[model samples]
Each structure stands twice: as C-alpha cells, then as structure tokens.
Target: MRIAVFIKKTTFHKGYGGIETQNKSLCEGLTKRGHEVFVFSPKLELDRNSIVENGVRYIFVSCAFKMDGFFGERNKDNWFTRSAQRFEEEHAKQPFDVVIGQSSAAVGVIKRKWELNIKVVSVAHGTIISEYKTFLNNMVGLREWIKIVSNTGYVLKSFFSRQREYVHGSEKVVAVSNFVKSALVDETFVDAQKVEVIHNGVDGGARPIQAHPNNQPLKLVYIGRLERSKGLQNLLKAISRLNNVTLSVIGDGPYLPQLARLVKSLHLSERLIFVGRVAPEKIPEILSQANVFVYPSLRYEGFPMAVVEAMFCGLPVIASNIGGISDALENGTTGYLVKSGIIADLRDTIREFVNKPDLIRKMGDAAYAKAQREFNLDTMLSKYEKILEDVVK
Candidate 1:
C-alpha cells in the first residue's frame, strides 16, 4: 500500500515528543511491512526540502494561510494547506492510497476530499475541550497567557469550522488513549462509534534491569520536556523529605532555570542530577539506571510515551492520576498513581518505594510484562496497518 502521512512537525524538525515518536515509529513500521510511506511536515532538520530516512520519505512544506474567521472555517491555511499542495505535487508522480493526518495537519486534504478523491484518517492527540478545561493546571505568567490565547483561537476554529471535517470528512479517527476517546466523544461530541482507542506505544523490547544495590541510594528518573506545568519543582518538594532517594532529570526546556532554582532552594542539588538531552538510544540505559520513573505533570496529556518507555525498561512508575497515566499504570500492581498536584500524595507514594524497595522489583516485573503484552510498538503498528487496509478496501 502507498500512504501519505501529514503532521505539523516531525522528529526531524522538532525534538522527540509522544506524537512525534508515534508518527516516526508508524511510518517506519509501515515501510517495513512493504508499504510505501511519504511524510509531510512544515520543516525538517536538513537543508533540503525532502529526505528519505528509515525507508520513508519526508517532505518539508513552507506554506501558511489563515481561516476565513478566527473561530470558524474548516478549510486550508496553517500547515495543512502548504503540505497538501506539496502532496498534490508528489501524487502526480505516483498516487497515494490514503492519508493519515495528525490533529489539524491534514485539514486541507480533508476539505478537498471530493476533489482529491482520497480517504483521510485523523489521529487526534487530545480534544480542544480538554485543553480548555486544564489550561490553568499546567500554565502561568505572561508567556503562558500568550500561548493560551493562541490556543484559544485554534479551539474556537476546531469547534466552529474544522470539527465538521474531523467528524464527517475522515474515514476514521484514532485516539491515543481511552481517556482521549472519552474527551472526543463526551466533550467534543464526536461520534463515539467513529473514534477508535489505540493507546500510544514505545519502540523498545521489554528489558528488565538488574537488581538494585543495597548500599546505593534509590534512583528515580523523570523524562520529558522540563516545563513548569510538568511540576518538576513540585517533584523536588516531594522528594525533599527523603534523603535515600536521588533523582535523574532527563531532557531540557525553557523551565530549566526555574527547576534548578528549586533544586537549590530545597538543598536537593546533590541528590538530583539534571542529565539534559541524550540520544534516543541512550533512553534504555537511563531507564535501566533508575529504580523508578516519576511523571509529575499537572497539565493535560494524551498518553505519555515516557511512562510507556519506562515500563518497557521494567521500571515501575509513580505519576499524576490524569490523562492516560491512570489507564497505563495498573495502580499498586504495575505501578502507582497519585492525585495530580498533591505533593503529599506524591511524596507518600515515593516513600513507599524507598521504604519497601522490594515493591520496585515486583511491580517493575509486572510493568515490563504488561508493556510487552499490551502496548508495544509492534501491536500499535499492526493495528494501524489493519485499519489502513480496511479503510482502503
């Protein structure tokens, strides 16, 4: 099968994130299954407009436009128009069987469905409704306010204009989690029957780490963009009460300095180490190095690949009880979930790991087993392949 994948940005241009990682894995996986895959993104890392890596083609688009009004109008503009124009240029060479769009990335193509004579499948990260309700949970200050104002405009457009295409113009819609499916169905009023829940998966074989040493301090890791809304400072506060636990913070972002100040204030400078951006291959090693994974996010997340990757490495997780974390982590079995933004709850959860220590091994083993059986990359790829084939038929 020949396929066209549309996303606003990509791992080649943007750094690794859950959506970017999923798209990258899906494209490569489809190609491995003897399918032709072409990816369209707003920009790429290389100087050329296009590059082929992992047997998939990446086309960089440089187009932009505005909707008729701020709140309404389903067609064209944004990254959608420019990428669709490029796709048309490529389709002349060899037509594609279908297009897999990420969020609003393929809005233009969906708008021109009859004209293009193609089927579109939208992959929604999360609904605009969830973002609106949880905006304050993860945001603050002037810059965040500006960001929300921009997001608010998109939310209005999503509701008034583009939501129609999302519902009626696509062959199907894939939500990254059951939680996301609920938001799309209940909050966005999308037809629940039309939305399929395909939980996000990480690309890694389940690998359990060796036993922890009794002499060393218990190791904990937090991997993701260091945003204030991620509650890294709060994580620091939660861990301050315990001296036996040390944290390894992986990733870099605008909130680094603020997090650093908190580390210093709490005198956790020695116990907590910031290991900024490492190669993707290094992730397994980092996960193995830690006894547990911490996801202290206070924002609305779809499904965090970090948590999945951690589980893949056989590390139990302690995360905020929101988004898909609750679904991913089988509380007290595979891992534990704490009330979002509750420092006491988070601290208490960590204390359980510190005091018992043996729970890590038991839960970590369960976590690894769960990851291999439920949401590994292979399962996700197979589901996507089956859906594409069904839609094309």
Candidate 2:
C-alpha cells in the first residue's frame, strides 16, 4: 500500500513527546512492513525541508508557525491549502491506497477528501479542547498568558470554520485512548461511532528485568515535554519536602526556564537533576538507573508512550490518574496513581516508594509484565494496519 501521512510536522525528536514518536513509529513501521509512505508536514526554521529516514519520505510543505504577510498571501499558502494541493498532485501521479492524518495535521487533506474521492483516517493524539483546559489550569507568566489567549482564539475560529470538518471530514478517527475518544465525541461533538481507541505503545524489544542497586538515594525520573501542564512545579515542590530523594528531569521545551527557576528556589538544584533531551531509544537505559517514573501531569493526555517505556524498563510508575493516564497502570499493583498537581498527594506517593523500596522491584516486575502483555509497538502497528485495510475496503 502507498500511504500518505499528513502530520503538522515531520521532523522527529522522540524523547521530546509522544505524538512525534508515534508518528515516526507508524510511518517507519509501515515502511518496514513493505508499504510505501510519504509524510506531508510543515517545516521549522532549523529543520531540513525534506528528508527520508527509515524508508519513509518526509515532504515539508509550509512554515510550522502560522505566518502571513500583506493581503493574507501567506494565509492562502497555509498548511491546509498546501497539503491539499500536494495530495492532489501526488495522487494524480500515482494513486494513493490510503490517506492518514496525524490529528489536525491532515486538516488540509480532510477538508478536500470527499471532493478528491479519497479515504482519510485521522489519528487523534489529543483534542485541542483538552489541551486548552490543561493550559488554563496551569496558567502562569506572560508567555503562558499569550498562549492561552492565542489558543482560545484559534479554537473559536477553527470551530466555526473548520473544526467540525476536521472530525466529520474523515471516514474514521483513531483516538489514542478512550479518554481522547471521549473528548472528540463529548467535547467536540463528533459521533462516538466514528472514533476508535488505539493506545500508544513502545517498541520494547526483549530486555532483562531491571536490577536496582542497594543503598542508593531514591532516583525518580520524569519524562515528557517540559511544560506547565506536566505539573513539574508541584512535583519539584513535593521533592523539596522529601529527604534523600533525587530526580532526573528528562526532555526539554519552553517551560525549561521557569522550571529551572523553581528548581533553584526550592533548593533542589543538586538532587533534582535535568538530564535534558534524550533520544527515546536511550530512555530505557536511563530508566534502569532510576527506581521510579513520575508523571505529574495536571490534565488530559493521550496515552504517553513514556509511561509504557518506563514500565518496560521495569520501573514502577507514579502518574496522574486523569485522562488516559488512568489506563496505563494498575493502581497499587503495577504502580500507583495520584490526583494530578496535588503536592501532598505526589509527596506521599513518592514517600510510599521511599519507605517501601522493596515494592519498587515487585511493582516494576508487574509493570514490565503488563507492558509486555499489552503495550508493545508491533501490536499497535498491526491494529493500525488492520484499520487502514478495513477503511480502504
């Protein structure tokens, strides 16, 4: 099958976040399975406009940021219009078997899908509404305020203009979790039947169960994009209240500066270390060094592949029990779940692991077992392929 995948951006840095990681996985996995895949996406300033990695071609189309010049010429050259034009051009040359959209990144294609007589399968990583709420919950600083304001305006404009089209335009919507599925139907009012839940997963090839060193300070790791919605400030505050607990902050983003300031103000500069922008392939090695995986996100999330990968590394998790995060681990079994952004809840949960270190290995074993049974990447890829086949038929 020749697949055309439309994501907002094709550039990948897996350690940064899940969407790109999953997008890369999907494209590469399909290519490895002998499907020809072409990705259409906008390019950033520092990124190459075109590149092919792992047997997939990435076509960078428009600017990633919404930039428009005089007379709205740039608006006419936006992602939506560009992607559609490219799709038609490519389709005419050699017809595509299927079209895949990564969230609203395929908005351009879907907007014209029916007109072009094509099938579009849009993958919902998470809804803008859910993210908007999370951002509003963690609102801080002028930069954050700016984002909130801009995003609110985007939502309002998109809703009346193209939001519904993004949902209904596609033949099917693949929600990353039941949580995300709910958001599409309830929040966005898409019919529930149009959505399918396919959880994000990790490659997690065979590896030995983790072995932890005795007599070490509890090493806790948090992996995700550095952002206020991740609830890192409260996690840091919780860490500050504890003794002999060291943290490894992995990944980077705009929120780094504020998180850094909070780290110093809380006097956790030494213990709460920032590992910074690790590739996803290296994450398990890093996880092996730590005893616990902490994800204190304050609101909705698609299933984070980090959570599954941490479990694969045989580290027990302590994450927010909100959205699809609640689906990732068995409460008090594989790991523990806490109320999002509550410092006391986070502190007590970490303290539980600290006080009962033996539970770490025991829970980690369970986590590894569950991840093996459920969250492997091949399993996800197979399900996706089936969806594509069925959709095409």
Candidate 3:
C-alpha cells in the first residue's frame, strides 16, 4: 500500500517531541512492512526537498515560518494548504492509498480530500482546548500573559476550529486513548463509531532493562518536556519533602526557567539534577540508572511515550491517574497513580516507594512484562497497518 503521512514537524529533521518520535516510528514501521510510505512535513534540518532513508520517503514543505509559533501568526501563509498542493503535485502520477494526518495537518488534508480523492485518517494526539487550559494553568509573569493574549485569536479561529473540522471531516479518526476518544465524541461531537482507540507503542529493542541497584538516595527519573503542564513543579515540591530520593530530569522546554526557579525556591538544587535533552539512544541508559520513573503530568495527556519507554526499561512509573496514563499504569501493579497536582499524594506515593524498595523491583518486572506483551512496536505497527488497509478498502 502507498501511504501519505502529514505532520507539521518530525524528529527526522529536528525536535525531540513525542509526536515527532511517533511519526518517524510509524513511517519507518510501515515501510519495513513492505508498504511505500511518504511523510510530508514543513522544512526540516536536512537541506533537501526530498530524501529517502530506511525505505521511507520524506518530503519537506517549505513554509514562511516554523510551526512552533503562535497559531494565527504561523498560519498566515496557509502552510498546510501549500503543503497539500505540493503533495498532490509530487504524487500526481501514482496516487496514495490513504493519507494519515496528525493533529493540525489532518485538518488541512481533510479539507482537500475532494481533490486528493483518498481515505483520510485523522489521529488525535490531544485536544487543543485541553492543551490551552494546561498552558493557562501554568501562566506566570508578563511573557506568558502576552503569549496567551497573542495566541487567543488563533486558538479560537484556527487551532480549536481545525480540531473540530479534522474530527468531523476525516473518513476515520484515530484516538491515542479511550480518554481521547471520549473527548472527541463528547466534547468535539465526533461520531463515536468513527473514533478508534490506538495507543502509542515503543521500540522494545531500543533499550535494555537494567537490574535495580541497591543504592542509597534512590534515583528518580522524569523523561519528558520540562513544561508546567507536565507537573514537574508538583514533582519538585514532592521531592523537597523527601530526603532519600534524588531526581534526574531528561528533557528541555519553555518552562525550564520557571522550574529552575521553583527548584531554587524549594532549595532542592542538590536533590534534583537537570540533564537537559539527551539523544534518543541514551534514554535507556538514563532510565536504567533510576529505580523509579515519575511523570506527574497535570494535563490530560493523549498517551505519554516516556511512561511506556520507562516501563520498557524495567522501571516502575509514578504518574497522574488522568487520561491515557491510567490505561498504561495499573495502580499497585505497574506502579502508583496519584491524583493530578496534589503535592501530598505524589509525595506520599514517592515515600511509599522509598520505604518499600522491594515493591520497586516487583512492579518494574510487571511493567516490563506488560510493555513486552501489549506496547511493543511490532504489535502497534500491525494494528496501524490493519486500520490503514481497512480504511482504504
């Protein structure tokens, strides 16, 4: 099958976000399965119009500005529309079987589906309103306030409305979790029957699980963006209350400065270590050194890839019991799932693991086993292929 994947950005060129990782994984996975895959994205680090690597083709769409800016400001040149035109021109000879779009790009492809005449699948990673609310929850100082005000029109006009159109316009909608599917149907008014829950998968072979070390000052790792919505502030607060545990933060984002200030305020400079952004190859190495994986996200995440990656590394997770996180973590089985944003609950949960170190190994083992059985990359690829094939038929 010939598949066209549309995403605003990808890890292939630059950035190390979950969406980019998933997009790359899916494209590579499908290509390996003998399907011809073409990924369309805005200009990337690679200075080329098109390139084929690992049997998957990548087409970079040149835009006026990067997709990481304010919504209204970034959409001025109709980047997605221009991208769709470029894709059509490139594939005019042999049409694609189906076009799979992620988030905002999905809306663009769906709007042009008439010209493309292909099955369009919109994969909802998360809702715009939910993301905005999370950002609003973490607002501090004049900079954040100005950002919110500047993006408000764009959020309402483009971001939010595009999500609605993407859900309603696409031939099929892929929700990363039941939580996301519920949001699409209940909040966005997408047809319940059209939405399918497909959880993200991780490369099982990417990392080797290390044996838990019997070391003092238990090592705790959090491996996502250092954003306010990620609940790192809550984690820092929780860590301040405990003496036996130290933290290793393994990503970078806009909220890093605020988090650093919060850490200083709490006087947890010695307890927490910010490792910044590391290559994907080094994630397992970082996770292997830790006894516990903490992801105290305050927002409704679609499905956190870091949690599953940590599980694959044989580390028990302590994340919020919100959205798809609950789907991945079985409280008391894989690890503990505390109430979102409650510092005391998170602190107590950490203390529980600190006191009962034995449960750490036991739960880590369970998490590893679950990741192998359910969240393997091959299993996820198979499901995705089936969905694309079925949609095409």
Work out the TM-score per prediction: 0.94, 0.93, 0.92
**Winning candidate number (TM-score):** 1
**Tens-digit per-residue lDDT, 281-341, candidate 2:** 7887888888899999887888888888889888889999988987789999988999987
Q: Which stretches of candidate 2 lie above 4 Å from their native place?
A: 12-16, 63-74, 142-148, 205-214
Model 1 lDDT per residue over 106-188, tens place: 87788787788789888988777777767766667788787877777777777766765665678899988888888777756
Sorted by TM-score, highest first, which candidate order results? 1, 2, 3
Worst 10 residues of 3 by lDDT: 205-214
Per-residue error for 317 in candidate 3, Å, reads 0.4
In candidate 1, position 95 carries an lDDT of: 86
Model 1 local distance difference test score: 0.83
Whole-model Cα lDDT of every candidate shown, in order: 0.83, 0.82, 0.83
Candidate 3 error regions (>4 Å): 44-46, 65-76, 205-215
Tens-digit lDDT track of model 3 for 274-309: 999998888888888888999999888999899999
Give per-model CA RMSD. Answer: 2.3, 2.6, 2.7
Worst 10 residues of 1 by lDDT: 65-74
Relative to the true structure, candidate 1 reaches a TM of 0.94
